[model samples]
Target: MSTISSASSSTTTASRPTARNLGPKPQDNRIPVTPAVLRGIFASSRTPLEERSISRVAFFRFTGFLLSCLGIAWAAARGRGIKNSAALLGVV
Candidate 1:
């Protein structure tokens, strides 16, 4: 009984997460695009859009962003200000 109590008392609680103990920071794999890079990408014929899938991926991502923005605007306008059906139609 004394040995069990001693063993339990000897065990330490888990330490909190510290910067040193925690593993290395997570890496972001995405390439950041600037306006100049975008202009170069669009203007340069050297870029083989056919050879890569990045264009298609970018197109869908951009389309989704636009749609989400539109939905948010519609919700904000209708949720608070618009009450009547005619006003809602006008908003649409």
Candidate 2:
């Protein structure tokens, strides 16, 4: 039993030095940016003028759809007086 316990303790002590050396040691400050990475980031940052025009059209279409939906919901709720008059009815 004493020999087994000593062997296990020695193995544990041997691993501590290797575990401490396995981590980053403050000298790994290198940027790995290639041309492909730079081009990808640049292309995604700003759209071209033609693409901007298409995006503007899509934006207005989506805005109009959203406004129409909001108007329908507002008119329906106003007709029912559920959202506004519920507070007065003590159901809120």
- Candidate with top TM-score is 2
Clashing pairs in 1: none
Instruction: Give me the overall lDDT of model 1.
Output: 0.73
lDDT of 2 by residue, 1-92 (tens): 99999999999988776654787766687668899889767768777985678779999999999999988877777777766756535678
The regions of model 2 sitting more than 4 angstroms off are: 1-47, 83-91
lDDT of 2: 0.80
- 1-92: candidate 1 lDDT, tens digit per residue: 99988777666333446567877556656678999889787657555755356678889999999999989878976777876666756766
Task: Tell me how many clashing residue pairs each candidate has.
Answer: 0, 0
Candidate 1 has what TM-score?
Answer: 0.36
Native RMSD of candidate 1 (Å)? 9.8
lDDT score for residue 92 of model 1: 60
Best lDDT among the predictions, by candidate number = 2
